[model samples]
Target: MGRAPCCDKANVKKGPWSPEEDSRLKDFIEKYGTGGNWIALPQKAGLKRCGKSCRLRWLNYLRPNIKHGDFSDDEDKIICSLFASIGSRWSIIAAQLPGRTDNDIKNYWNTKLKKKLMGMIPSTHRKPPPFPTIPLRTTPPPPSSSLSSLYNDCSPYYTSTNSLTGLESISAAPHNFLNTSTTTSLAINCSLLQTQDILLSPLQYYPVKDSLIMFGGDQASCSSSDGSCSQISYGKEIKQEDMGLHQSHMISNGFEENQRFMFDYGHNGSDHSLNTWSSTDLKPNGYLGNTALEYDLEEVKQLISSSSNGCNSFFFNDESKTQERALYY
Candidate 1:
């Protein structure tokens, strides 16, 4: 069967939008709100256009209150928090940022921010996602041997464990780590040593390992200071790492067994809400580490109010404010 014609494509005015059409749509919405009935909107707005077209033009381009210009630092926080809360649902996030659109934001995220984040992650951690293709080879390698070798190539051999009861709480609900409020990008890689999984040394407070050595993305910029692990903020290296793992003996001697992988939190140096709740170190605000324990929406409202004035507003709650202050120094 042939495909049906589009509602707006038949005997309809199309192509470059005229100023009259723009004015009609704007004035109609201003006077009587976006009625959500696009099919009827063009007639009401007195424009020779389809409802879908009007909706797209207004939502993606001409919304009056839309914030246009480079995204601000605070907007970055909102993006991170949204990513942590809901992975890649850019449309939902755009709803929160008044004037933004899902398409524009999604493009910026994939191109610019994603590149910077991939830099902080290790090379080994990111495996090229599998692509689908039917093999035409007359005689394929034995399935078992091929599968075993692949495992040997990308086996996860290292796992980092943190003892804070709070991490235990956070990990308990693996879903909560991606809560609506925090912005954290998690990428981990484990390089194989002869012994298999390497137990991370608790001796170091924080550790950064390079993981992306195979495909030649970004390397070297993925180290961490053991000291800052105690804080919410994580750090990165100044330059990219050298990519020498491709043909090194590390892969030849069946010693591909000795190769290393990368892991990353993609955590920029933002002060996370305190998670520490121990009586001994608990601040007046009752936080555990950087996660907030008790706070109110009014405080959030207050911070949001302050942010409008082009100021650096702390987290909406008192405990968050304290951590933000400490982060300044």
Candidate 2:
């Protein structure tokens, strides 16, 4: 059965709130408060509006200390950093900035901030560059070579090379190479490789035992000491039918296991710069640690500054231009 509606649909006013309606809502809430139920507040306030509409109007427009002026440069940094880290969790992002609401940030992001960021880069760099393919083989690595050393020999750019070993194509570049855009590219590439028939060369292959040894044998499955258990296949091809099962396995185990199987890259530093950012952290999240965070801020500032000369500039260096741009917000 269909659920009952919250209020009478035909009797309620639905369009933009009139000035008289706003005054009544503001006065009622100021005097009697919400009575702890938004669904019932509108009727008590003597308004014909829906409770949801009244709630939105009261919170977004009539709330005290709500700032509707232009967003500052620091606000822009906070928004961009939070967006890069958490992607569109507007309420969480809004919490970081006082007097700014989630709806305002979301609208600014969609209509202005997104376009400003995209316009900073050339059209060519916006698209992912072609990646080189690795040949498939079953040969083992040299006894003296470590996983970290082997991955370091790979190239950053996706270009063909004569090296027979498949390690040359993998990226061992520093964390600075991973910006918001490159991280996005990596995410796309990783998703495509998992779904598609892309193959990796033998040099990129590592036995389950090797992964256990490299990652300090901390994984639950790696705790087994039997030689037979260590011989389990690590880099076998996954068919489309097995994707769901594979994902379930990943959920049970963790993404680290999937990373171990898919990318043979190694972490060398004590800080583990290659580790992805944690979304829960209050600070800026960067794929490449502190360096990436700094780069992200600089990039945002540069883009905003460069766009000052445009017809619809959000940023202004001149004091005179600031007042003009302020009117648009």
Candidate 3:
């Protein structure tokens, strides 16, 4: 059997409401309110209308502060954004738009707004960009003599995404890049975050000839105590006076004559812009950072010729699996 009607169809009026009917519904509601039950409101107001019909008339047209007509651009944006997030929940969308009825928004979305938005939509005619090009490997994968024998295992090196991509381009670098079987390179990069047992370590120190992939991220990039800094030139020949080194460390590096060793660096332990590798960032007392030991020119030649720990053939590591390891200071 079909369900019973809300109000007797024979007794109640249907179709468009007249001016008198709209006035009666509006006057009755404003003075007494809905009294919590819309189903009984029409009967109480002595109207030959369905309770649902009276309610719809009051909410959609007769209500105070009721808005009608074209929506504004800001309103269009709000509707679009809300619709994208929650979809066709007309009542919720209406709540955000002050004075707009849910039925009105529903009608607007269905008959006009939906079509307007569709008209504004961009066409999918243009093709997507092509994938990047990586060169094919000319040589086989690297050997098993990985970086543990080279740079001692360190934590992850934090660099920009582009730097990491550069390192991954070439997996196997030449072993002789280290200049030492025991890894005497200046730069070191490593990470312990991955689950894979295999790691990739690509290292190239100062005076490295191969020019393997370099990853650069300096924790000391902000070595200045103030608020500004500049990169010190790598491989730049600095005089002893300009170098920000401790007096003892310089003495250990070997001193030929007092004037020659300390002249390049400033005499007052000052890291002047002129004396600097052009670095203006100095501690209040004047120190950029502890520089690597500066070996005397004569002593370096003597060490190269010495049989023990001599500057001899270099080395490096290339493995099957690869991870990027780069150290920049």
TM-score of 2: 0.41
Which candidate do you rate higher for lDDT, 1 or 3? 3
TM per model?
0.36, 0.41, 0.36
Q: Count the backbone clashes (under 3 Å) in each candidate.
A: 31, 0, 12
On a 0 to 100 scale, what is the lDDT of residue 154 in model 2? 25
The segments of candidate 2 whose C-alpha lies over 4 angstroms from its true place after superposition are 120-329
lDDT digits (tens) for residues 97-152 of candidate 2? 55666788888877666544433222355563343423322354343332122222
Between candidates 2 and 3, name the one with more favorable TM-score: 2
Model 1's alpha-carbon lDDT is 0.36
Q: Highest lDDT: which candidate?
A: 2
Q: How far in Å is the alpha carbon of 208 misplaced in model 3?
A: 63
Give the distance in Å from residue 307's predicted Cα in candidate 1 to where it truly belongs. 31
Residue 243 Cα positional deviation in candidate 3, in Å, after optimal superposition: 61
Among all windows of 10 consecutive residues in model 3, the one with the lowest summed lDDT is 150-159
In model 1, the runs with Cα more than 4 Å from the true position are 1-8, 120-329
Candidate 1 to truth, TM = 0.36
Candidate models: Cα lDDT each: 0.36, 0.41, 0.39
